[model samples]
Target: MNHEVIGGIPVLWADAPGPLEAVLMFGCGVQDETLRTLGTTHMVEHLAMSTLPRLHHEHNASVDLLTTQFTCTGRPEQVVAFLAAVCEALTALPLERIEQEAGVLAAEDGRVADPATAELLSHRYGVQGLGLAAYRGPGADRIPVEAVQEAVDRFFHRGNAVLVLTGPPPADLRLPLPDGERPDRSAALPVLRTGPSWREEDVPGPGLALHGDLDDPALQLACKLLSQRLRDTVRHRHGLSYDVGGDAVLAGPGHGERTLCLDAREGQEQRVAELLWEEALRLARECPTEDELAEEIAELREVYQDPRSTTCELGEAAGALLFGGTYQDPQTRLAVLEKVTPDEVRQAFAAALETVLLVVPCGTEVDPKLPDGRPLPRRACGTEGELPPGAKVFRPPLVDRLRSSDARRARLAVDGRGLWAREPDGTVHHVPFTEVVGVEMRGPGRVVFGRDTCVIPVVPELWAGIGPAVDAVDAAVPGQLRYPASAFRPAD
Candidate 1:
């Protein structure tokens, strides 16, 4: 790869057969925003792109869990103009367009990951960082103007950006972004669960997540082989599923989550979920055959050897540079892959299985087991116990409690330190005021969100006379952490 510095931003380029394709990437994305400012990065991207006049080029921009990219494919001059306009827009964004763009964003309603994968991430990392993928924070229309300005000042700048291209930079290329230091993201987000467990969610199909080294070639191959096997057995053979896919998300250097999600046929969710887990256990215990390993390697080799992948490879290198990761070239990676034995693949996968988190469609029953014959426990968000001492208790409305046995047992409590809720099943959820990440103000209620993924709803429908509880929450949580409930969401 050829490297240069243009307008104070690092540029990585490689020769390839294509009209000039350029990707300007920023290290910040959804992970950088707070729940109160969830869509700030995306809002920034839309605001910038909205400023561009119509041009005869293929161009788009996107924000994912960890990065934002503005890409374009066109003649050399067209590419130059596109990048220049993007930088100019970032430097002096059109704040006046906020209202119009918020509506646009609401209509877009984009999600970074699929439902099952997003739920797995949330279960693993709580409600911050990558886990934010599972939530829709405050609506775009509710995003504060100050938050948008702060996002731009902190992340959209020359110091935090990289330029990757399929060809050399044109002479007129200009990146006029304001100068700023790269934000520190070296600390890995705390993992909420290192689990060999399962949970039910409102997903279309079943999914599996393993927390492990993102750079492990064996684990990568294992995931690829698992998907291939699932496609053969679930889709082609038994007709239980139509699609099998997965993703590897980077959390920090050498660490992340790898997920495999499969869409199941109707009325067969439970069977498909069981099959998915059974296949994973089989691979972990028995290991892949030499031919299976070779087949995956051959497929990867085809992908890496293609000339069209030059831009993709350069983009990977640029991401590694932006974050703190080691990037291996295609040849080096292939060499490493070729040396991986079936036993190594088995061990890597088996070790990862220790941190496996499985998600199945709601209403589907699954009792999965580990290779050692231990049942994977069901995971729930709260502790199994009673509420804390000296807490002010609020019960469900008397009329509703008279009609339902579960309502009589459910209760909410508030103490000097935090809020708590006890479900009919005796699971207690606590969210301390000090750790309160966000508090959404429903019409006459409050939904408290905590750092540990515990949520306590102080809504009148659930508990009678919640005015006192709502007032207490407002007094304790800082004003900055509070926002009106999203208009797009129904009251809960």
Candidate 2:
């Protein structure tokens, strides 16, 4: 492996002597954009490829908090052609197809979520910088053509990019990207007002999701060990959950977010939730055994040594360069893993108790207390307001797809200070506007008020005349209470 500077861009080259794989990574992602410009990078990516000829190779693009990646894999000739075409297309993006590409992005957003990434980031990071995961990406309807062009000029540049390849660089490849300097990607650590918080979500099945904000490598190893213990105890010994595991992800440069998830069977939701807490409490009180640490280290080695495609490895290397992380060989990483002490792992587990955020299945309740005995707040206080007498109350139907016998009916009152909802089983919930931390417009005629403990989903059907109510609430609530829902436009 070697690193060189090509046209002022970093190139990470590795020799695998097989089919060619290439990845071009840019240093700007969602974290680089303000709420107003959220999704601009994505829009540029779409428009860049909107007119490319489909080749007999695998190609895809992805946007993350700190990096955007375009990857291709195939025979050597195919790889060369695909990458060359991408570079040419990026240089002259078809801005005329912006509207069509925006529609495509909207359709992509409506698909079922892979809760592992976005769901976790939203809760752990809050609705601030990277936490936009909780809501939809930038609303394509809001960003104009000028914004997209500016993004391309600022981020898609030689100085801010990295190209990685399994073989040598393609001959005569022309990468005519701009020569802009790398944008500063640093920001203050995300502060969660209700952090170590618990929230529920609409998911396909039952699961217990937890994440901690400790960024140390030793803590990362501890997360792996804890995940294995939960899997063994809950799945094998207790038969309460079908799957359980934990992992640490990079939130930014040198910052790691750890997540532990447990999936429950049909009737074991509550039981699994209870067991998860019990285990967490017990782990906090005791250090892992030496044998446990040894086993985990051995498993880590296996993972590091496992064979993977060169393209995949190159993409990872390129992403690391973009995010201010250095690429570590498997041996170096294993050495670090081996030196981690049991006491260090235990201390990390204990520290994690302070920053834990619990994401449980909807309708499943878990105690929100931290292991060290601090009560988590359930609602935002000042946002609450007194209801005015005879305020206009509007009961709108649930979104068409969500309208079922079991779906609850949501009522929004203009100038009433809050929302009232009734469940199918006769339960009434009053969530005040002051308590709302954020609001998301799900689609046409659908809105969700985000509270600490729950979310209020209101479907103002077409012609329900509830637009005034939404406007009034938006005006009445504090600026931060409205999550950037406008960033997410519904599919056409």
Candidate 3:
């Protein structure tokens, strides 16, 4: 690989056997935005791409959890034109086109990660940072102009970008981005739970998330081995599942989550969930055979040695430079992996299992127990059994209470510090006013979201005389954090 500086941006390139491919990557993505501005990065990406005229080259732009990339494959001149246009667009995005592109984005309705992996990230990091994957925040049309400008200013500048190419840059290549500093992303996102627990969610199958060091070769092989085992046992042997996959997400320099997900056959949700957990436990308890380790290593070697993977490796190196991570070349990584033994893999996986978060399909009955005979507790938003002291309480209306037993048990409470709700099952959820991330103003009601993933509804249908609760929320939360409900969303 060769490195050069072009127009204030660091450019990394290497020789390849095809048309030149270039990727303009920025360090910002969904993780940089708050709940109120969840789609701001995506909006920025679309707005920039919308400025490009129709060309004959294959080109696209995408925003994931941690990085945004604008890529194209064409001759050197075409690649140069694409990168220049993208950089120019970022410097002065067409604000007038936001509305049109908002509709386009809504139509796209894309997700950066699968449902199970998204939920697992949410369970670990609440509703901020990497956890934002599980939430579809305010609608695209509702994303304010200021948020878009802020994201561009903070992340789209030359200091926060890197250029990766499959071949040498053309003499005409230019990256005329604005100057700025790279945002500090060295600190890991706060973890909400480091658990060996499980929960039911609206997913197609069962998934598992284990928190660990992203650079650990043993843990990486462990995840690969577990997926292979599930593919053999769940898909081939019993035909209970059709697909089994896994991913490793980078949260920081050394910390991240490794996920394993499987899609089950019909009427096999519970069985699939059991098999997923059983295999994970078994792997943790016992060492993998040398053949299994060899198989995984061989597969990885194949991937790294492929000639088409030059751009992919360059992209990885760019990510490491942007995020303060140490980048390892494919050969170095393979050499390290080849040295790992079955016992090391087992030990790494066993330690990770202690922080595992499992997700099964909703309505599936599961009582996952740890290897020590302890039941993995179910996860919920609130832990308090009752409301706090000195809270102004509102109960369901008399008509509704008389109609159903559950209505009588439900209640809403508001204090000077925060808002709280007690569910029909007696679980209490509290969202402190200071930590309120976003408030969705639904007609006459409000949906209050907290940084800790707790949502409190200050709506009228659930409780009688909610005027005081609504007033408390409006007055407590800052005007900037509140927005009227999106027009595209369904009415409450």
Estimate, for each residue in 1-492, the C-alpha lDDT of model 1 and write its tens digit.
999999899999999996889999999988888888899999999999999999888999999999999999999999999999999999889999999999899999999999999999999988888999998888998899999999999999998999999988998898889899998768787888899789899999999999999999999999999999999999999999988999999988889999999999899999999899989998999879999999999999999999998988998999998997878999999999999999999999999999999999999988888999999999877888888889899999999899999999999999779999999999889898998999998889998999777888898889999888998999999998999877766665
Which stretches of model 1 miss by more than 4 angstroms? none
Measured against the true structure, the TM-scores of the candidates, in listed sequence, are 0.97, 0.76, 0.98
Which residue pairs does candidate 3 place in steric collision? none
The full ranking of all candidates by TM-score, starting with the best, is: 3, 1, 2
Residue 221 displacement (Å), model 1: 1.1
Superior candidate under TM-score, 1 versus 3: 3
- Evaluate model 2: give its TM-score: 0.76
lDDT computed for candidate 1? 0.92
- Summed over model 2, clashes come to 4
| Number of the top-ranking candidate, with TM-score as the measure | 3
Poorest 10 consecutive residues by lDDT, candidate 1: 483-492
- Residue 237, candidate 1: Cα error in Å is 1.3
lDDT of 3 by residue, 1-492 (tens): 899999889999999998999999999888888899999999999999999999999999999999999999999999999999999999999999999999998889889899999999998988999999999898888999999999999999999999999998899899999999998878887887989778888899999999999899999999999999999999999999998989989888789999999998889999999999999889989999999999999999999999988888999899998999988999999999999999999999989998999999988998888876788888977875778889999998899999999999998999899988888888889889998999999878899999888888888778889898899999999999999988777855
Tell me the lDDT of candidate 2.
0.64
